[model samples]
Target: MDLESHRFISYFLPDQRPELCHSATIEKFPPGTVIFEENEKPDALYLVLDGKIEFSKRGGLGQYQNVAWAEENDFFGEFGVLDGQPRSARAVTCTSATIAKIPRDRLMDILERSPGKVVLQLFHHIIHYLRLTTEQYVNQMVHKHKMMAVGEMANTIIHDLKSPFTGISLANSMLKDLHQDEETQEWCNLIQAQITQMVVMTEEILEFTRGKATLNQKTFNLGESLEKFQRLNFIYWNQHNINFILRCDNIILNGDENKLMRVWQNLVGNAVEALDEQGGQIVLIAAKLGQDALIKISDSGPGIPEAIQSRLFDPFVTYGKRGGTGLGTAIALSIVEAHGGDITFESQAGKGTTFYIRLPLC
Candidate 1:
């Protein structure tokens, strides 16, 4: 059951030419054509002679979620016939395709014959494929959970090390105060800087549960950032009848401003998509709270689904969004968290949502 060589099924059943003439009919389809849909009764199995076919399943929000694909010479649709069940996935033409459709009766007849080894091989191949798919998914889940566990361990380790780091910093400060010698002061400053950098670096990696990354530590101040966002998104908000508002306290923060900008833009974009044509209001507020910069983006729209709220920042977690990769919030969390910040949200079904962000201020 080599997918690429499934056209060989004809040789075992009948001569390829006669098989097409009597046992099967050759059909052509254009790209994006739906060959079959999930749960549909199987009437015919197909052998792709040319071009490509894709298979997808309906995801949580009724979105098309890709599962597998078939291409030239790949035969499919035998599952339903063999099990006397409906199709479990949707199949569509990915490109203009030439396919040979074998009737259900023809396939069943082959299974009854003595030389049904090819069909048996095909079953073995598909079962093996399904087993591999399940294994991969299980492995992925295991790895995700493992990373989360490791992240917890990292947090504990960092916390334990913090006391010693604090002591070192305090001692260094005392030395700087006691030793007024210029050369000694310079050496103390260098030591203090390196020690502070190490603590900051440790804090930065504590939230990298998914993996690792480098964050730029450049410092800059945002002046009326909320106003700037409102200006840029005014038309978009107006077009959607979404009232936009802005408030700012212009706080300075250290990080790659460009990346932070992208994060803000993505959050706002997510809000727009969450909202309907009935429109709503989006308010962006920025200020300073003690040593941290505080930003809150509130949207008056349908709130995030509770099913995915807890794992909202996990990759591929999405609800209400069509064709969304679900990486927007996850990436936003990563960027903000790596800067020793936190992003949290409060959402209630019909009441809308508010996302709060806290980042260290320079």
Candidate 2:
């Protein structure tokens, strides 16, 4: 056994059974070799003995971004081992590397019989991981709050100035029309439309700050809600050449009708925008699952990238699209969760995306 390999084990499995340490085998990989891909089943934990490893994911636009890097003495793959879940990121060798592959079953066995050392080590790793994660989360939250605060402040200013802005826009339109200049009229009309959009967005920001603009819960037919939502938003969908389909029936639920309306509105609006004039199909389905109601909205647009899925519900993490505030889905999720419900989504590149909402039946 290499001294470096032993040192790696000592860092994690110190005071463990010697036999368990001997059970781990040193594996080597060359640069560009994929150690594992995201979502692969849990197998063995890899402790890097030497060289470097890169953790990356495919971006929403079909590009790869390196999110993390691991070097000698560092470990990767513990998350999958501990959670019994698939890998969340792709790991590839950045150079010639030697790694100790610690079998998951053996690790579990040791953890069950001699939990103290294992638990201690696991706890230490978790604490360190969580510390870093929490720091990043706190920083992101602070940044988001700052952005929201600025947005709110700007919204307030806009609200205060809206009357004058509207008056000026109307005056410009009248002047352009009276001058009989098509170019000037078009420019004025565009400016007025943009100002109008800004006004609407400012109102939404104010509403989001108050947290009082969500749906008011009531017992209503889910099918009816879908129909009404579709009818109300059909023109927007049609203008964009998008197809809307409803596959739900007479499923009823106790939820805020207006809030659910917003939910559908936001989701559908997102899907349409994601399609970006290429046009696609949007499907809404509702069904009852025992004591819960299940609603799914699927889109034939480019699916959300795996990189952003974990933080997709977080506020203001946009993909840099036009008119995207990145708060719609976040607000939608908060509303659903408040109603004793949960929301989840699935997406894949080039295929499509689907959002699932599960709520307890009233």
- Model 1 accuracy (lDDT, Cα): 0.75
Best by lDDT: 2
Superposed model 1: Cα runs more than 4 Å off: 1-211
Q: For residues 1-362, write the lDDT of model 2, one tens digit per residue.
A: 36344544564445564756676888889999999998899899888888999887777997766667778877788888888998988999999998888899987776677647657866787688657755655675576576678567857787698788878887987888787778776566656654655555455556666664544567998887677667666767899999999988568789777666667777878889989888989998888888998989999988888888899988776542588768888778877887889999999888888999998887
- Cα error, residue 320 of model 2, in Å, equals 7.4
Clashing pairs in 1: none
Q: Residue-pair clashes per candidate, as listed?
A: 0, 5
How would you encode candidate 1's per-residue C-alpha lDDT over 1-362 as one tens digit per residue? 22234554644544433443467777889999999999999998888888999888887899886667777766788788778799999999999998878788876775566366666666677887688656755666675676677667768878898899889989998999999999888778667755654554344445456476567668676654445445555667788888887777868777876567656876887888889678888888888899988899999888998888999988667766666656668768988887899999999999889999998998
Off by over 4 Å in 2: 1-141, 150-215
